[model samples]
Target: MVLEKLSKLIAEHKDVDPAGITLETTLESLGLDSLEVVEIIMEFEEETGVAIEVNEKLKTVGDVVKLIGECE
Candidate 1:
């Protein structure tokens, strides 16, 4: 459920196809810079009402999923 919502958010923000994103997809590969990533994270937090700590460890979609799981 988290992955689905996250993928949609990312796709909408980047104007990309959500179907192309997966757990293995890296943020860098999607052409997302650090500022864009932080904006996405902030938006996600607002939508989900979950606080996510931004860290250097976040590299892939899966990493974010894990972080969300831990936050929840």
Candidate 2:
């Protein structure tokens, strides 16, 4: 489920290398601009049945994983 959700967001960039997207991959390195990141968070909420607030706090990919884990 996480892969599917992430792939949806990752698919936006042609240069995004799949192998580089580990749990530790940063959003900036993944080419996720602020708007794309918000869309990703929204997609995750819809996909995983989790509600995430759009705040300035979550600034990394690890932050996203932590938020999803908290939902679980």
Candidate 3:
């Protein structure tokens, strides 16, 4: 569920196909800029009502999935 939501948000902001995005996908591969990433993070926080610290170690979609899971 989280992946679907996150992918949809990313796809909305980026030009890539959302169907191609997976947990293993890297944000850089999608050509997303820092501002886009920050927007997505804000959307996640809004939807989940959880404040997620933007971590430098978060590089993959799977990392975000894990973070959401931890917050819940």
Candidate 4:
């Protein structure tokens, strides 16, 4: 469920196809800059009620999923 929502959010924000997004997809590969990443993180936090700290560790979609899972 988290992956689905996150993928949709990323696809909408980046104007890409959600079907193309995967756990291994890197944020940089999607052309997401630091500010864009932060914005997405904030949006996800609000939606999921999971506070995510912006850091170097959040490089891939899987990373974010894992963090959200851990938080929950």
Q: lDDT of all predictions, in order shown? A: 0.89, 0.68, 0.83, 0.85
Q: Write the per-residue lDDT of candidate 2 for residues 1-72, one digit (tens) a residue.
A: 565456556665535655556667777777777788788778778877877776666666667777766766
Predicted candidate 3 versus true structure: per-residue lDDT over 1-72, tens digit per residue: 889988988888886677989999988888876777878989989987988777677788888778777776
Candidate 4 residues lying further than 4 Å off, grouped into runs, are: none
Task: Determine the backbone clash count of candidate 4.
Answer: 0
Q: How would you encode candidate 4's per-residue C-alpha lDDT over 1-72 as one tens digit per residue?
A: 988988988988999998898999998899987788778778989987887766677888898788778877
Model 2 alpha-carbon drift over 4 Å, by segment: 1-4, 12-15
Query: What's model 1's TM-score?
Result: 0.93
TM-score for every candidate vs. truth? 0.93, 0.68, 0.85, 0.86
Model 2 poorest 10 in a row by lDDT: 11-20
Candidate with more favorable, higher lDDT: 3 or 4 = 4
Model 3: residues >4 Å from true position, as ranges?
A: none
> Regarding lDDT, does 2 or 4 come out ahead?
4
lDDT ranking, best first: 1, 4, 3, 2
Error of 1 at 13 (Å): 1.4
Candidate order, TM-score descending: 1, 4, 3, 2
Global Cα lDDT for candidate 2 = 0.68
